[model samples]
Every structure is written in structure tokens, then in C-alpha cells.
Target: MNEHAVDILTELRDLVREFVRERDWEKFHTPKNLAVSLSVEAAELLEPFQWLATGENGELSAAKLDHVRHEAADVFIYLIGLADRLDIDLSSAVREKIAMNRAKYPAEKVRGDARKYTDYD
Candidate 1:
């Protein structure tokens, strides 16, 4: 079954949760280990772009983009798995953080500016 765009994230998250459960790997997925894995995967995603010159972040070749895509998926999988084990609701957590960021970076003061939020003061 196809998931709608708004539902796909949750659907993929549930799929990862079920895949881990069926394999009985819960004991192997402590938050610390998952966090480590997530960081490692994120680093791997950066590998293909590491040697690119300036202004090259958007210039990845098709093959490199595919590699980046897979590594990013790995990061997302581990992140959701970690969140599931911690009993965190991913959507609400992200929403709350976004709200905090919005408060810290009001558009009137921050628009077109890339400085840190404190710079808005």
C-alpha cells in the first residue's frame, strides 16, 4: 500500500520498528548505541561530499547522490528506532523544537540573516 506524503514518515518509522522487533534486536538497540550508529551513519553520508570543492554541495553526481540517499536513509532508520525505544513521539518532539526555534528566531529580526539566534537581540 502507498502512503500519502504526510503519512509516509510514520509508516516508514513503523516498518523499521516492526523489522527490528521481528529480529528480536531490541536488546541490541540501547539509546547510546543507536546514537553512536546515527552519528556514524551521518558521517558516512558526508563522505561523498568531503573532497568536493567550494560550491559543490549541490553538484553531486548521480552515483554519489544515490550513495548519499542510502546513507541518509540509514540515519533516519536508526533515529526512528532510537526514538521508538525511548518512547518519544517523533512528530511532537520535532514540533516542539520548531516552536522553540520560532520563538528564538522571530522573522522580523531574523529575516535574511544567518546569524545565531542570540544575534537577533
Candidate 2:
């Protein structure tokens, strides 16, 4: 096992690219297919919390948490793979979105509130 784990998102993207190059999988990795896979993986990640009510503490066993972690990893892996396939820069996009969110929800208005950005005064 590799003790030193590389950046997971970058590793996943590189793995996908290498697989595509080795097996010609790019022909099947269309935007629509990737989008559907992304949604499916996201749904898998949400499955563990499906029964939990809002603001309720759900019972998640260690095994269940492990399963959730795997599902979440799958979701992220597919997302980065899709981004790589589409030539999108995920890091820059995330930074840009965070900047936009900061402008939308200044700390003074949302300091301790859990309200939506639009609901903030």
C-alpha cells in the first residue's frame, strides 16, 4: 500500500486519463455519460443519510461510516474525472465560487446564522 497518498482529486484525474489512454475509454466517457455517473455516485453518497431528519443526529456505525466514506470517494473521483475529461480547472473553479459566496454572504450578516445567503439582511 502506498503510505503517501497524493492529492486524491489529482490522482483520480490522472488515473482516468491514463486509463483512457491505455484502453481508449474516452470514446465512452461522453459528457452525458459522465454527468449521469456523477449523479449516480452522489446518490450513493446520500443513501446513508436518507432516513435522517434535518438537524437530527443519525446513528452511523463505524462500518456504515466507512461505507459512506467509500461512496463519497466514488462521487469525488467521478467528479474530478469528468472535470479532467472536460479540461476544467477544478481548483480555480472552487476558489472562484468561494469568492463569490463570500461576497454573497458577508460575515456580519451571517455570523452565527444558518440561513440561506438570500435570506440574510
Candidate 3:
């Protein structure tokens, strides 16, 4: 991540920490609990698009879009919380995963294709 992006993420993470601390919710924010919350929030994030043929690419009503936005934020917050609980660096992990995926799905070989790396000859 760039310096600005890192700063934003740090700010958000700190905000979540303070919110949890203020609520005395840290005890409940265990790695396991946070992981479950994250997964649930991810599923909620998919709710707004559940029946949309075009998914996010199609226009949504303002209310539905707002719902999607809030669900996405919930997922992000839980993800950051889980990272904190696990002492993981989200940016580094994402970057490393991107690098690994680049190798696994090289553009030259995977471009215009929608198959897993294992599916390619």
C-alpha cells in the first residue's frame, strides 16, 4: 500500500480499537469470534445483490445501495479487527497474495480466460 493508504488503514484500525475498548468488547473480539463476524458480514455484503442480475455493475436504488455500503463497511471493520487480533499486517498480506496470484495466473496465460490456474494446461 502507498503511504496515504497505509495511513487511512491505520486510522480506521485505531478507530475500531478505540470503539471496542470503550465498549469493553475486546474480550468478545477474539480471533475466532472476529473471524466468524467477518464471515457473517461478508455474507451480509452479498445480500444486496442476491437477486440482482447485473450484480454491482447494475444500478441500484438508493436504499439498496446504502444497505450494501453499510454491509461492506461491516465486513471491512471486522476484517481489520481480525487482523489486529492476529497481529497480521493486512497490507503486506494483500500484497503478498497479489504477487502469488500474479505468478499463479500470469496475464500472458490467463488473460481473457476465467479458469483456475490448475485448469490450464
The Cα local distance difference test for each model comes to 0.86, 0.77, 0.92
> What's the ranking of the predictions by TM-score, best on top?
3, 1, 2
User: Model 1: C-alpha RMSD to truth?
Assistant: 3.2
What lDDT tens digits, residue by residue, belong to model 3 across residues 1-121?
8999999999999999999999999999999999999999999888778778886545687888899889999999999999998999999999999999999999999999999999999
What is the Cα-based lDDT of residue 11 in candidate 2? 70
What C-alpha lDDT, on a 0 to 100 scale, does residue 23 get in candidate 3? 100
Residue pairs in clash, model 2: none
Residue 37 C-alpha lDDT in model 1: 97
Strongest candidate by lDDT: 3
Q: What would the TM-scores of all predictions be? A: 0.85, 0.79, 0.96
Candidate 2: where are CA atoms >4 Å away?
1-9, 20-23, 53-58
lDDT of 1 by residue, 1-121 (tens): 2337438767887899899889999899999999999999999988888768842647788889899889999999999888878988777787799999999988888889999987655
TM-score of 2: 0.79
Residue 99 lDDT in model 2?
92
Q: Which structure is stronger by lDDT: 1 or 2?
A: 1
